[model samples]
Target chain A: MASPPRLRAENLRSALAGPFDVSVAAGRCLAVTGASGSGKSLFLRMIADLDPNTGEVWLDGRARSAFTAPAWRRAVAYAAAEPGWWTETVADHFPDLPAARAMAARLGLKEALLDGPVLRLSTGEKQRLALARTLLRASPVLLLDEPTGPLDEDSVGRAEALMRERLAGGAAIVMVTHDPAQAARIGDEHLVMRAGKLEPP
Target chain B: MNPIVLTPRDLAVAAILLLVDAALSVALRLGLTRALGIAAVRMVLQLLFIGYVLQRVFAIASPWLTLGVLLLMTAVAAREVAARPERKLRRYGNEAVGLIAVGFATAIASILALTTALRPAPWYDARYAIPLAGIVLGNVLNAASLALDHLLGGVVREKPAIEAQLCLGATIGQAMAPLRRAAVRRGMLPVINQMSAAGLVTLPGIMTGQILAGLDPIQAVKYQILLMFLLSGGSGLSAVAIVYLAGHRLTDARHRLRLDRLA
Candidate 1:
């Protein structure tokens, strides 16, 4: 029998979003595209268990309730659109400096930017840094919500490349984005969220 | 020197102080004159009523009565803590957190004082237990309220940041660590300020009251120092407890923030 999908949502319904089901296989990306306020982000939050919802989510055949929240979150990371950084210096966010540097470079960030204060970074820089921070965890799956919302075209391309690399390495991803081309470029499967429900692209 | 007893006639003369305040309010057109007058009347009535109640409480000296009074005070303090915050836990949540945090601090602090420091003939003597508990409760109430306010407001303001941290695999405690620290610090700030400026800025109310009541300056100073230390301990414990409890209330078992807990 084929291995269970890497990430599976079974009738996961958020307070504001739907009772929807979807699955993404390992080494694949499922891109969710929707208009603003169409519940794409809400769907991701539900899968990540960041919002109160009905139904069950299974990761690699393990029920979400089986693992502790921290462990589940570590395994299936959620990268929010507007990421939060608690420290003053950028490097403080990542545990390993060398890995952080490598990830930063992969996301088009300069090495010196690590030592600088996070408050002074531009919006695009912050966005890319947030993604780098999430990717640094090497979680088995990624739930990305508009991960490249603020990046320019070149940065977007670099981000897409990094995501493609993650998918190539056998990590499953669920990404919410407004860019159809982004969906077309990296997504192995496509779902559009509308009126709080998921539909075929 | 003996402290002179003030007759009603003598008290009438002291009442002139309110007129001075009223006059100042009128001169500045601050419109506080009527409020001041009403407040003065209210203070007089409340103090007299409380004085009568304390006399009866001391005479009875019942442990059950003492516990009842302490619980009542705790409930009132908890309500104040809940009401002062612009953002707060839901009514029942606020009350529960406040009662637990403030009640715990006050009980521990007062018990320590009674058993170790005061050591009255009866450890449960209302004179020492009630007053000590009241003073400690008053200070802890302030600390607890400040902590709850800071924590509730911080959670709302930092929702995006907090959720982000949660998204990054932080446990609930890890996600809320910064705001929790901030809330505790804010709660303890008043006590810290009082300690730092004790001699320089203003003589504290307790020391001044003792001095005015004919205690020796040195004796009053010793008592003030002890009281300050107790206040510090009480405030710190209360602040930390309130923040931690409030933090727990704001999140779920899944480590996700439940903003709906807040009003």
Candidate 2:
């Protein structure tokens, strides 16, 4: 079988990440679980190369330093608990509307929401839409920080289905969450983020 | 014309603002006190120097000298705007070069062409061109610098979110969409406010100067209206362009937000 696309983090540390060392394989959904202030999200951040860390990382056997930041990120998708919305219209968030719209619709968003003001979007709507935008282009590696959080039963189910589809497309997923039941359902392997450690599932 | 003098109350208010600004600045970083100091002191020094320089220049009436000073001022203002944000702090000289080349040259060319070429009167006129450019560039510079600081600071703060966008097939420019838009909008705000406030509530510096210079009230109002529009438009473009340029500091050739190279 093909070697699973992997990201090896050799001791990543930051104000948020602390000090972490782990290698995450692709086609494998890795869930990082921890309590509040446990650095779960920070671990995902350093692995994703979103924040500054002292540790080195390798993606797909190539050093992260080998690829420019934009190039690396293009191949890796990350979502935060809070995403910045910079424009009045939702369509402004994505370069192409059809892609964003298609994924958004799958997550139960209407086409009218595209042209409507983004300021009007609810919190759950914001999270779902951000996830949709990510799912549309869903990169080879995905680092998600609470992509689905505190949602009702129905929305969580839809999100879980979407996550599976992304996995089917062969993306390495690194996710941070506290919910064990949710983690068990979506993650192929689980990792706990506590005291700056990526404990294997 | 009676020399316009600040009343005792006006002086008191100025003292209060200066004192309050200094107190607040001690607690705050990013040179609010320095700006206040510049506002209070440099405005005086600049005006003093300009009066003498203009007196001599107005007598000599050399188009080249007036032209030189105007270019120098614009270039200097642009450098200040671009230098306010720290990229590498060590590599700031390169940033200054870029800001001067892009921001200064662009603003200078437009103002010169518009004021001199199109509305050609007694060319190399200090009375008109010098003050006009100063107001435009000075206001816009802070806006530009603030925008850069905000965007970069936000990038570091929101790196994961931005990186996430790129990982999901977003280009560097694509990833920075929110930031770029925010930077430009935030930069453009003051100019927009001045445009909104030009005539309704307060007399802007330009109109006041024009009136003090013995221009008729009606003619001064007309000039102020036109000047406000031009000033707004020019500063808005300069501020936004400087912000984009600031973003270019981090992104590589393909346009990803690269913080590694920056200090």
Candidate 3:
């Protein structure tokens, strides 16, 4: 098993990185629920090393700062709430066709969206598509910020189920959400963040 | 040498006016003033400094110095624009080099062949090389800066729609394609606009300078066309190079996000 929460952050903080002071375990999905603007997204960003903070974070017993930026980012994959569309076409978005198509269908999207212009997709469709992209990397630690926050009830359920099915392999999952039901259903552990601090539950 | 005609009172008034403009530029950005005072000051200061530096450089006439200056300018601009403290800056420095080089080389090569080669002047002549190279590099720098800014900002702006793709195993390049397009478009837009408006809308700086130097209007027009074409090519090439180079820099050893550097 990956050793107990080894990533270190002395006073990690940012617009979206953190003021976080906790470590997370591998293979455990830690669900974060908190008030709006309570730094939950920032906390996850801190873990991903995507923002600047005073503290140190360790991955696999190595200091995050010690690793080059690209290495550190690659180790932890973060999926934001709205996700970006870097390309016009779906095939362009997903270089690897089979995986993209399979993940798309798994997330209840029509594989037809792959050939279609991404600009035409609805918000829920985008959310589903973003998840498909994340699944492509298959990172060991998945940091999700409201992965389904923009989706409808049906899409939310579909995404939640997809997350449950896809994330395994001793990978750590840190997710931020407002829905308590999602917290209960998706998380193996729960933490409520407010005013830049995480309350262990 | 340029003639000096201003009196002390005029100089003082001019200085005061410049200072006032400086104050207004930053104030405008901050809503503290109504004009771009700081921007005007910054532009004047930067241009004046470059003017003095180039005057000395032209006097000394060293080719290596020319190349060194170009490299230093490219590095500094890259770092300046890449200043997202939370985002990594080092890798982009090298990538910026690649972008600037494409612009620099292409500009030099085109001009050397078209004008200098046709006339066969000394390759190191500052009168020709300095202004021409500056024009090329300046255009490239602008494009590269825009491209990088758009790429990083676009990612932040549209991250969620991207993250789901990450869950499904999308490569970083795959994830970033949409952003790359946005960035390139943003970078190259100015060049496109300039190309579209070449003659009728504005009197281009090069052609105007040539006319002042006693070149005929027809000759000046040719020079302007050559320069505009150089700038357009430089901008386009630099934009493409910066994107590709940055794409390479963005990934880690395992081809994952450069999370640590993002901070």
Tens-digit lDDT track of model 3 for A24-135: 6665678999888888877876676544456777776788768655556666777877677655886877768988888888778898998999789998888888777776
DockQ of 1: 0.75
* Candidate 3 CAPRI category: incorrect
> What overall lDDT goes with each candidate model?
0.89, 0.71, 0.69
Question: B212, model 1: CA deviation in Å?
Answer: 1.6
Best by TM-score: 1
lDDT of 2 by residue, B180-249 (tens): 7787788778778877777787888777887877778798888776666666566566656665666776
What are the runs in model 1 whose C-alpha is more than 4 Å off?
none
**Steric clash pairs (candidate 1):** none
Estimate, for each residue in B1-263, the C-alpha lDDT of model 1 and write its tens digit.
Answer: 78867799888889998798899999999999989999999999999999999999989889889888878888898888777888867767888898899989988888888898889978878888888888998999999999999999888888888887787778999889999999999999999999999979999898898898899989999988888888889999999999989888899888989998887
Per-residue lDDT of candidate 3, residues B1-263 (tens digit):
34245476875687787667657757676564434556666876898898899899888878788767766665555554455223444645544545454545455544664465344356656656666666677677777778776766655566655544443445666666777887889989998898888787988887777676677889889877777777777777777777766666665443345433443
Q: For candidate 2, what's the RMSD?
A: 8.2
**Order of quality (lDDT):** 1, 2, 3
- In Å, residue B15's CA in model 2 sits off its true spot by 19
